[model samples]
Target: MAQAADAEGTVVVTTTAEGGRAGARALATAVRDQLPADRPGVVAVGAESGGGAVIVIAVNTAARTAGQDASTLVKHLLHGRGGGSPELAQGGGLPTGQLADTLAAVPGMFTAG
Candidate 1:
């Protein structure tokens, strides 16, 4: 199991790539632009297995408020990677753990697009 925790309250999101490399950093920058100017966010490069990237993202204060679990949220982002390509991945940590570490394992999630 991996670890991914935010500051008290933060929005965490993950995404798995279909091929090539991790795209978390790029996605993070994109997502950041869409968020409120006052909010802080962080994106981490997860892992890469079977040709896809797992991008993990954390939103400040809003994501947690919407009943989102770091683990599940990150998992959701890696839903597809070819029929059972596997690479059974994880996003969140042991509830109150480090979120970045977990995401770092997910392929190219941390690459610069």
Candidate 2:
């Protein structure tokens, strides 16, 4: 797993895990669970399979309060299709090479809370 934080204290984490969509979701949830209670964050978990990747984005409450939407982020950053509430979202069919870059850009997608 890799992590980055912005000036606003929003953390972004990226990880390549095993399982497919289920694994990605579990990883994202785990990352979110590990964050400090006061810190806002986003977790992007990707699993590579066949020729592409599956991604799951998990947003903590503080991050969601700061206007971060996992569903929108997955759609915009991964160029994939999926849906979920603002706090958690899952998507797939992303270019494997794009996963890192997409996760790296996550911190910048938030608005100040």
RMSD of 2: 2.7
Worst 10 residues of 1 by lDDT: 80-89
Tens-digit lDDT track of model 2 for 1-113: 66656646777777778877778888899989887767778888888866788778898888888787889988877665877879889877778888777666666666466
TM-score of each: 0.32, 0.81
Off by over 4 Å in 1: 1-7, 45-101, 104-113
* Local accuracy of candidate 1 as per-residue lDDT tens digits, 21-95: 335434544554555544333333444534333444444334334443334435554443211112112332222
lDDT of each: 0.39, 0.78
Candidate 1 local distance difference test against the native: 0.39
